[model samples]
Target: MSAALPQVFPHAGLPARVTVYEVGARDGLQNEKATVPTAVKAQFIDRLAEAGATVVEATSFVHPKWVPQLADAEDLFTGLRRRDGVRYPVLVPNPRGYERALACGAREIAVFASATETFARRNLNTSVEGALAEIEAVVARARAAGLWVRGYVSMCFGDPWQGPVDPAAVAAVVERLLSAGCQEISLGDTIGTATPGHVRALIDTLGSRGVDPARLAVHFHDTYGQALANTLAALLAGITTVDASAGGLGGCPFAKSATGNLATEDLVWMLDGLGVYTGIDLPALVETSRWMAGHLGRPAPSRAVQALTKD
Candidate 1:
């Protein structure tokens, strides 16, 4: 029997294809309370790729003292049976982390930055300016090594400590990342307080700052059920890349209020209905998520996964 599919209704003004930057491996598993086995992590990445995800964030090289869940970064990255035509980008916190990724033979890497000072202090243990300064050096070195670098700007829409964030402040951080030789930037709604208007406004603000929307991506948390809505706003604003976790399985360990990331299944389902090509096999993706959830000993949080898997 064939799996169920959403009926296609072509949407005007939407891109022909969207790149789903799958973060289930690094971002998703990083927040887990239990340590997932290294082999399981490798299999998870391979399954996501088999399900047609071209850009899967493999793992982070942060110190185990910070994110202990991903302590096996080197082991996992070394044993990964990389697929053809798929890009696995790992997170590198600083120069030392970049060195680890480089030694692991990482071809692509991402650096994290924060827009708000409070969260920067808590998450990165530095001020916003200090974080940018450190990330600038890391990004420059990665680019010099011919590695594709992605910059992640967190707290773009809102911050728990600071409340509503100024879009202009977010743009400043983005401008620095672009200046630092980052190939792309993923704006993070870390607290999930963003509305559709706020999402569009931030992207517009970046555009006015001479940052092209083409070089941007959106990373939304679904704490308030607004991830999909904010994503729609970004898509309409000509942003194509989106960061999502399989089975909706990630939250910021540093930010207690932050919740699970926008689910890959949910995003794919919506894009499928809108006739936006993602090249993903929905049933295969769901099965992969379900498999991972079994390892986590919980049901998948994705609405599409729950509904479609009901017997």
Candidate 2:
């Protein structure tokens, strides 16, 4: 990305700047069936940072049996060329994972919980309260270790088994994470069933409970092709942080109906057209995702990347 250029949007009540949290290295790649070499993952991180990603989710500290792809979290963090302004956060399932991440010199990390009881049972063989308790323990230790912690509430909009989820249910986990020392909470539409109206309702639920939208982030999937639309709703609702994956590379291992996340390229295209500053170079991101798609033996799923790469 080049020097920051001033931006002025003709639209009213929109933020001038937005933060794109890159999740390609962790949430994106962890769902791949094939193993991506640690070196490739590390290089992916390097390119994302060079492409002007300020916050990149590097890896996870889950057990190898659970998420074999990110089992080498320690090695990946060690080999990474740490950027001065970039933040690399790892995902930890419990205090054990947090301990491993802390030992690896991790400065920031994230813990995930679910809003649906079925998802919690299927994903972790536990209840929502059980998962929340686990993450709370990890967050406590992470805070005491002087590390910044983020929390994720998956299946926020709707669940396949249980159908539409209550906004208050999502807010319960969000508040729990915040009370457990999470500085930011990412609400995820795991199966991509969310629309602009649903996004607003969820944000309103939180806002009514005194949860500031500024400390919230939205992670939407593109299964039904509504990720960007939902993101725009989030932005208009006063959310400044958006989570995306490079090349549209992500799915949930636990959620069978999951799909790739909102592509960073796709989000950047919309934001750029709106005269919003994201400090990201579109061309660079396309080239990087193109390279990644080649390595993964698949075409990049990002509409912007495909449109830009085609002659």
Candidate 3:
């Protein structure tokens, strides 16, 4: 085992450090039952920056009817404090979303699509192929405008309506996203049902398909309480980027019982304890999550950090 990893970590020090993309402001807030005010979003983003999160997803520029919580994407993007070194990525569903993001001075953007045909039709009002065609155009436009593009493949592990996604299907979508010029692609467990074994298998499949492991990211939700285990599996498989939300802010609207994204505070706590350098200030991150939870009239679900700091 390498000196950088704690003894407790499985496959300690094998995969090295990972880049954590913070998505509390966008994906975390998009599914909220109550629309969070723009000011609160800006403050939340500023606090995330103070906690050493470099890649913060700011908001989505989708149609208001689809995700009403992010209806003020334009104002929210412009109102936030734009730091020098940190990146603010906004989700753009189509060419129109990309253009709107551009108008708000967005330098980076994210595009998303579901792997299942049913989800594609329900979520995007189109088929998988149709959604991919739109996303391809969005990617080209964003790249031409000198923007960083991140592709998101939802339901990588499983879907509510579609059970047990095929690894081949996941690989195909990943290939298309990479071919369309997305610098990185994040595979999402939209329903949070992934296990460690499944994570390893999917990564292996993607790797075998000529997908560069370095450009792959894992976005896991903690609904089944297996996110951390799956994250460990991804790290062992050479995935370097992970997506997490601070405070575990969002839940699955499709599956009401599901919780939210893996909390940043919890991930950082584990990484720090394992001697992994995430470049995060644990105390500051916990404070941010606590504050957000309080503001939302709830408690944070970050068991690690909450327990560590509550004393």
lDDT of each: 0.95, 0.91, 0.85
Candidate 3: TM-score? 0.94
- Model 1: how large is the Cα RMSD against the reference? 1.0
Candidate 3 yields a Cα-based lDDT of 0.85
Which residue pairs does candidate 3 place in steric collision?
none
**Residue 82 lDDT in model 3?**
82
Per-residue C-alpha lDDT of model 3 across residues 1-311, encoded as one tens digit per residue: 11322245434644557688999988888887787888998999999998899899998898998789989999999888888788899899888888898888998889998888878887788999999999998898888888899999998888788788999998999999999999999999988999999999999999888987899999999989998889878887888899999987676555554678998877876776666667778778888888888778778877754674554
All candidates in order of TM-score, best leading:
1, 2, 3
Q: Choose the strongest candidate by lDDT.
A: 1
Clashing pairs in 1: none
Please tell me which predicted candidate would have the highest TM-score against the true structure: 1
The 10-residue segment with the lowest total lDDT in model 2: 1-10
TM-score of each: 0.99, 0.96, 0.94
Q: Which pairs in model 2 have colliding backbones?
A: none
lDDT of 1 by residue, 1-311 (tens): 23569999998999999999999999999989899999999999999999999999999999999999999999999999989989999999988999999999999999999999999999888999999999998888888889999999999999999899999999999999999999999999998999999999999998988899999999999999999999999999999999999999999999999999999999999999999999999999999999999999999999989988988
**If both were scored by lDDT, which would come out higher, candidate 1 or candidate 2?**
1
Predicted candidate 2 versus true structure: per-residue lDDT over 73-125, tens digit per residue: 99999889998899999888877888888888899999989999999999878
Task: Name the weakest run of 10 consecutive residues (lDDT summed) in model 3.
Answer: 1-10
Q: List candidate 3 stretches off by more than 4 Å.
A: 1-13, 254-257, 309-311
